[model samples]
Target: MNREMMKSLNLKYTKKREVILKILEQSNTPMTAEDIFTLTSKELHMSFSTVYRSLSALTEKNVIMKELRQDGKTYFQINSHNHKHHIICTVCGEVTPIDQCPLHELENKLTQQTGYQITGHNLEFCGICPKCSKQAHNK
Candidate 1:
């Protein structure tokens, strides 16, 4: 499947790229380049630079989504066609995917009002998660 996706994107298929994509596919939450590097390193001998470059290429092609959160780290995840947003815990860096897009109606309204084509959008909410809030309250 990863091979076909690369072929469709006109990206040259490489084992390293395949491993990276597999790692992202298996992950439930967004991962930093370092996180991917650690996992990829466990599976095969690959450098951090190689992993980073693969991520960049994939992100540029929209094969994956890149998000920078309040924690100051960039995270990557597969760009599913269903399209979803995320909410991050500002304290512990937990990422939770939001299945429903809250901005679709707003996007339509904006396109109608401004007469501009809305191609895409990115939206993420950040706040203390329940666990973090509970921990803080306990303290």
Candidate 2:
């Protein structure tokens, strides 16, 4: 992805934003602004406020997804473009995206039952991941 898309959306792209996006893209899961800044501050010469501002802009342009985790910290990830929900590990904060969309049928059912058109939905399942489960079992 390039800044041209953001330009079309009337959002100015910056190198700081690019570096942040790259970090989010390279990460296997979502990242907090603090975590991002900690990793890139030396190389990017930016502040926490700068990282936060870039994240807000990226989210505004729909270039990334921001989610408030149970930890009360906001996490960001590269927008997949394909709508998918995440299943998060409660103990370790591991977020895994599931491609299986179970809402299509549920949406149809809800619309048929209530006669109201549903525009969108969000579903995030939470549970202990295998690693956490194993650790618990060993203890």
Candidate 3:
């Protein structure tokens, strides 16, 4: 999340989106629509349909990024241009951004070796989070 992105987000922010993005931005982990709906509804009176529609619009605008879980639920996070992927918790559904990219060198090499223009790529890593690991160990 850069300053420009934050500014742009604020510029185009709607009341619904503001609430949703605010929650995502503050969250240390990515959240599903149901999670967000529960959290947001607790703070303000909003319908699940509104949250779903807002999330759809935000994803379409590239303001927020979406990832699909194995359980068929969709999670969302702020769209940062820093080129990063996610490490998700299999148990608790937590998500953390991996700062370093595995494809950095590959992308550069591919661009140099071939004239084909590269746009972007998607990468995701899934595993148990620390909290879940601890819980499982205790159990």
Candidate 4:
């Protein structure tokens, strides 16, 4: 799949990029470059800069999406046409993707009223997750 995606993007497929893509594919949530680097480093000989470069290339080609979270760190995930939003745990920094997009109707209404095309949007909710809330209460 990585090879096919890279070929479609006209990117020269490399082992490093393949490894990075595999990592992202396996992840259930978006991950920071550092996280990717740490995981990739355990599997193969790769540098942080190389991971960054691969991420940048993949993101530029729309093979992956780059999201800037509240923590001011960028996260990467495989680009899927079934777009969704994320709810982030403020305390634990856990990001959970919301499968249902709540703004589709709003986006359609706004587009009709404003006479503009809505290409994309980003919406993130921040709050304490259940585990964190439990821990806080216990404390």
TM-score of each: 0.91, 0.84, 0.73, 0.92
Q: Quote the positional error of residue 111 for candidate 2 in Å.
A: 3.8
Estimate, for each residue in 28-135, the C-alpha lDDT of model 3 and write its tens digit: 666899989998987789999999998887888788888776767787878775556778777776678787889978989999999768877777788888888888
Q: In model 2, which range of ten residues has the least summed lDDT?
A: 75-84
Tens-place lDDT per residue, model 4, 1-139, is 4577678889989988888988999998889999999999988999899999999988999888998877899989888756768899999988788988899999999999999999888888999999999999999
Of 2 and 3, the candidate ranking higher by lDDT: 2
Go through the candidates in order and give the C-alpha RMSD of each one to the true structure.
Answer: 1.4, 2.1, 4.0, 1.4
lDDT by residue (5-107, candidate 1, tens digit) is: 6899889899999899999999998899999999999889999999999999999999898877667789899888666688888899788889788999999
Cα-lDDT of candidate 2: 0.84
Candidate that would win on TM-score: 4
Which pairs of residues clash in candidate 1, taking residues 3 or more apart in a chain or in different chains? none
C-alpha lDDT values of all predictions: 0.89, 0.84, 0.79, 0.89
lDDT of 1 at 105: 96
**Residue by residue across 1-139, what tens digits does model 2's lDDT show?**
5878768978777888778878888998778889999977867699889999888988988888887766788888888876668889999878888979989999999999999998667677899999999999999
TM-score of 4: 0.92
Give me the runs in candidate 2 sitting further than 4 Å from their true place: 112-119
TM-score for candidate 2, residues paired by index: 0.84
